[model samples]
Target: MAQIGIYGLGTMGSALALNMAEHGFDVAVTNRESDWIAPFISEAGDLAARLHPYTTLAEFIAALTPPRVILFMIPSGAPMDAMIDEITPLLAPGDTVIDGGNADFHDTRRRTAQLAERDLHFVGMGVSGGESGARHGPSMMLGGSAHSWQQLKPVLTAIAARYEGAPCVAHLGPDGAGHFVKTVHNGIEYVDMQVIAEIYSLLRNGAALAPTEIGALFADWDRGPLKSYLVEITARLLSYTDPETGHPMVDVIKDAAGQKGTGRWTVIEALRMGQSASMIEAAVGARGWSSEKATRQRAETILGGAVGAFDGTPEVLAEAFLAARILAYAQGFRILASASEEYEWSLDPATIARIWRAGCIIRSALLDDIAAAFDQHLPQGQLILAPQIAQTLARCIPSLRQVVCSAMHGGHPVPALSAGLSWYDSMRLGHGSANIIQAQRDMFGHHGFERLGRSGRHHGPWWD
Candidate 1:
């Protein structure tokens, strides 16, 4: 195994460093604080003897067995830039730096080029499954050229979440692609969680069920095809107790949710790429606005409406929620696919789905369906609309349609997922869904729309 150095001996870095050593790699750990990874290494192995801790970048580089490979687990943007500036000066030609942070893709691209001048390889890696997965095995995404990737593949594969004998890891295509995919992963997670939250609210408020009973209902769902990490989380959310009152925490549960910017970046990037990514963006915004209860309540009083009333049995509501959730996934996958293509990223949709199946927040049985769907379509994302997924969507469509209608009729925000699905469902299986682009030109530029029968263009205003 190759000797390696890992910077930032925080929760993820420390655990990952030990795992690397256990996997037979001569792993050197680094942090500004020299003692950071020491305790963790001591607990896991004879780290004071086995793991070398470096206090500075120059010292770390000079000590490295050459063709130096260092894994960075630091904050993105500024701090990363500062550290790289220090290390780039010391690194020998052919050395590699792997970024395992939630960095912006464009930034990754810039960094790759900056390092290339000195023959130093840079890889933007997206490592998922948090602290625990890194210590055990986490799903990993890599992006760079074949030459650069070959150097790190062995180490990454050994420390990744795997199924059968295959590592649940892949080298995404050139420059910044891994982080791009990971950004979309987080966005999908936002929508996935939002949909689950909506389901919980609908069940608790509309169905009037207790938290434990609700947890039981979610647990039942977990046993079926909908089995997933989100479902597991649904149970946890209900089981948590109020620290103050010892009451069922669900009743007094605060509506406010927190985010750490991945979801927001996904939306902004989607807009830059001209893709429709409203559902997840709306979810992020919802979390932000949810924190302001006083504003929400006062606005509701003045506006006279907010939450909708959608009456249905638990099964009926669950089906509706599931349908909408599927649509959200549908849009998310399409956006990711488009981004991959635009970047020339040879992203294996099947591998991506499988990697997502274990460690990430969006891990769901739906991933199995997605993997199969991609295999059936190969090089196509329309599989979500294919016969099998179509059937599943059809089974849940009635409820999903009802939920959207109810939410809309009652002045609630349904956002991108349901909105996209509703729009998709409205267009019958045929070409020309209202000639929207042509209509836009007619409305704004007075560019006459062509008539079906005659070759002449119609110049009359569309509305007036």
Candidate 2:
């Protein structure tokens, strides 16, 4: 019998099954579309030796070792529910079902409880690094009980990416924690990509540089503190030329971007938790705005455009990018900390950082510093308050200010960067301008306000 079973043959599912097979774990594989099985096995090359393909669900379930470990890489919502309903009766006590998709944490939590009533285990796992990473090694975040972890640890550790000899995988918490962490990871990714795009706009429009020049600049940035998988890929993207038109590949691509709702989910959850994720919000908003390409074009024609130039050096731009990146990450971490408290999951920012340092889209050198900061136990769990991060901010904030100011003058929209700076400024203020609003609220809505010295709620003199 196969050691484990995977019930999907899409890009991710196929790659993951091959990854397990290559690692010497016989993986029984099946798919909703039975035709996909033969093509997948044929493409597995020599790895097919360890792959046992089953076309039917019953046979697939029967092929796995007793107390079967079945991983579902299908769509997260109704599809997952439907699959569970079909598979639950086939599973025995102690059998585990893993949802290896980008699922909402709330749904994961509900499913976890639902499956437990039947004496079965449910694991919501967050897998990152895309197709190539799946075939080799991806960062894996698992949320389940101790028993489920014990059953899957050996296979997961072998297939996961490693950083400094340690697997970039962990049993984060129970039920929804892993998926929640992945949602935030994607949220941060949205801001990261948006910020880079904004910088590219500044370089292309304001600086009047060619795509190859910008690509060279990004390649250089990849060798420095800004080094990350995204930056590396972006450099290659900008440098590549379209075979048809001979234009830069990025130049020929449409401006409109698409999303899969994880970023919006992150923003919604942050608002529900009463925490600010302004950078992510800005990124999501920018994506929405990008989709209305015709509207943007009409607005540009009606409103005209700014004609100023960027006076900053590449070094200054890099510094500004770094500062904005740090602020965005700080906001994401705050949301994670808030969710941990609200859910009683005790999510570790340090462990999250360490795991993200490799095999993830947002993996970067900055995560090392973030991990170190959390290791020191940041005050109030605020990443911005960490001494090392604070010092880096001190050095980079001025450059960020210069970039934002220059971009505004140049009529370039840098929403994510601007939001990051605004959040940072708001956070550093000891006193804010909200007292007048509070007094107005008391006058109009009869919502009482507390006086500076007094403890109990007090009314403002405006009512008199």
Find the candidate with the highest lDDT and give its number: 2
lDDT of the candidates, in the order given: 0.77, 0.93
Candidate 1 lDDT score relative to the true structure: 0.77
Off by over 4 Å in 2: none
Residue range 55-120, candidate 2, lDDT tens digits: 899999999898889999999999999999999988899999999999999999999999999989
List TM-score per model, in order. Answer: 0.90, 0.99
Q: How does residue 417 of candidate 2 score in lDDT?
A: 93
Model 2: which ten-residue window has the lowest total lDDT?
Answer: 304-313
lDDT of 2: 0.93
Q: TM-score of predicted model 1?
A: 0.90
RMSDs, each prediction?
A: 3.1, 0.9
Tens digit of per-residue lDDT, candidate 1, span 87-159: 8878888988889999999999999999998888889988888887888888787887676688787888887
